[model samples]
Target: MKHLAERARQVIPGGVNSGQRSIPGLTDLVITHAAGARFRDSQGREFVDYHAAFGPPLLGHNDPDVSAAVAEAGRTVDLCGVGVTAGEVELAETLAELVPSVEKVLLTSTGSEATFHALRVARAATGRRLVVKFQGCYHGWHDAVSLNVISAPEKVGTHDPISTGILPEVLQATLVLPFNDAEAVRRAFAEHGDDIAAVILEPVPHNVGCLLPEQEFLETLRAECTRAGSVLIFDEVITGFRHHLGGWQAISGITPDLTTMGKAIANGYPVGALGGRADLMELFSSRPGGPAFFAGTYNGQPAVVAAALATLRKLREEPVHEHVFRLGERIRTGLAEVFASLDIPALVTGYGSVFVGYFMTGPARTYDDLLRNDANMFIGYRRRLLEHGVFELPLNLKRSHVSYAHTDADADHLLEAAASAASLARGDVLDLTDASTMGGADAHR
Candidate 1:
């Protein structure tokens, strides 16, 4: 792994293609191939694959159905000059049928594109400039929604850009606030009701360790957005197909005006979709000079659409959600027990097949609660888990995912690995509550 990382650094900007893979105290593996719930590193070591391609491999790596579908498309479909294939139309129909808030669909090639277009549509439809996004909620890498996904502990409500390239006007247009803070949402709406184009969030925030949305918090956003005439966009890229067939909107019973979906929607394919009320989505149409512009060369590319249709159909027809939910429950229970028995001050937060273990004392309700966990200890624990052949991302402040391919045996192995890792992590003595040692809980629940 180290050798490959070194080689990658010689060509790639920072050894890895993405910044998340370049975390300290870890060597990112160069994977050869993956199947079911395990993948082999370049050195031929197979690890139980809990990373799940950062959430897209919900049905597991190279699922036979998905692979076959892609193969069929490769044989029968064209990559260029196809001009609206049946696969794209079918995939759009499937999305409209399955996702609860989707009355219409506009396909994109990536999650970032989906989010970028959604924001544009919101701004165009409402004739407003400002957008409301909560702290710790990752929409994508676009300049409009780039700030505050993972900022410093002191920068929670400051609308600070996570990256250096974002413009000052972009930061000013975004109203960053704490998650689960209803009063803050109300206050923001009250103050900028006229200027706020949309209020966007991850209904079930997983980027910062599967922070579930409080019912009141979601309801508050819905009510305030309606009152303020602002579009409510749910960035369900990660939670889309992972949580339910209809995404988080189905579970929460509070639908957003626009929903951006990707990642798990296609079960590891490069695809993204923006869907919402027909009126809002129509803003993208060029007919009669529709205000918002959305264009992409690879929008609804045939092979990806084929994989997505197969994945979504399998998710809809089979008992996939039930099986994964059972595994998630077992993990949550087992981790709590492991931490209690080990006498480790920790909190496990998640819903469905997504979870993360934070070295903390109590429940985590917001991004600030998440920031209080000991990063160094968590990093060590993650490294120990990797040593035990459990393949979760080596980052501390991120979520780990389980997939449909993970069996009962895989869950048991994960529990065992976690227990061993927790024990190995005990030697690093650090205060879990001290803000200086651990990032302080900056916001009250």
Candidate 2:
């Protein structure tokens, strides 16, 4: 057992919250140092990290320029958390420039806080209480958004309670609808449209393992939210600065009233930003009639903001996403071939830099499609991948992160290991239901 696990278990709850890092057998391999997509675990095992800390390290781990910027900012942090910093304004303005819809921006320490404050603005601006969210699209674990992330196995569209600690009053304000179902959205709006303060969602649903939105669904959401006088928020915490300098909204071209960004903005540093049109942001303005007050000690830490500035500047010039997309597709296609060779039912999801393996029967278009996959087998595959020096975690597993540090060479190496891991997992599945334990030398016979 990794010593960190024993040490961490005594202090941190769950040892570690990152699903990929906290595997049952191998928290010891949980990485001590990382740079440019490769990590060295405590035991000196190496891995091409795919879970870029669940979605932030867009510039890859330990980028020199970002590190330098953070260092430079350290010199001036005498002003950090002291009050206002030019670094904050610069990062905010940078976001406004990159994301055309963002005329004003606010910073927070984490995505949950960003969403929490953004939601407050949404409600106070509209003078409404209801908050709409799509099932399987996770915004954050905040009380307001902690419900109905996925429907129950027996039913679609019905909201399933995820966390029990959420207050009943908070749950009452949440309205969870099935993803990509415009009709369900329309019906919700038809009933409580006027009361819905905002509709917050991940444009590309990553919570259910990197599921993409159906064609025109995002456009329809923007249109619906506008017509209903409710704000639209894109929780791009995972997507921001991920695929490109513009991110998913830039690529998708479906702008929301507000967008929450973190993770990759600073390449693993803690930073989150809420940005949107000036008028909507006016709700957070300090005026007496404005929406609410939002502030934090580390909300705009110079080090993190500087890191973001460096990452963004690099993204504009380097075009690393093209490489990430190509490598991502390579991994997906390679995994498909591996599954086909073994006749294991599985599929790949995600675009550009991010990708996820769905151990399901068919394409994971909706939550129902996701149900056809074998969760246990996926978990087993995750364990085997770690054994093979290719680390991975289940989608149902808590947030995992990956980045551009992985090269084509790394992708090939991972796929080669994945083929063996998939075969091993298929063997385990065979043992589960048979009398003969007949998943022979090759297993699944």
- How accurate locally, in lDDT, is each candidate? 0.83, 0.73
Write candidate 1's Cα lDDT for 216-327 as tens digits. 9999999999999999999888889899888899999998999999998889888999999999888786345677887888888889999999999899889898999899
lDDT of 2: 0.73
Where in model 2 is the C-alpha error above 4 Å? 17-21, 27-30, 150-152, 285-289, 394-402, 429-445
Q: Write the per-residue lDDT of candidate 2 for residues 124-201, one digit (tens) a residue.
A: 789999999887776666788876554446645554555567778888898988788888888888899989999998
Per-model tally of clashing residue pairs: 0, 14
Give me candidate 1's TM-score against the actual structure. 0.94
The weakest ten consecutive residues by lDDT in model 2 span 436-445
TM-score, candidate number 2: 0.90
lDDT of 2 at 153: 68
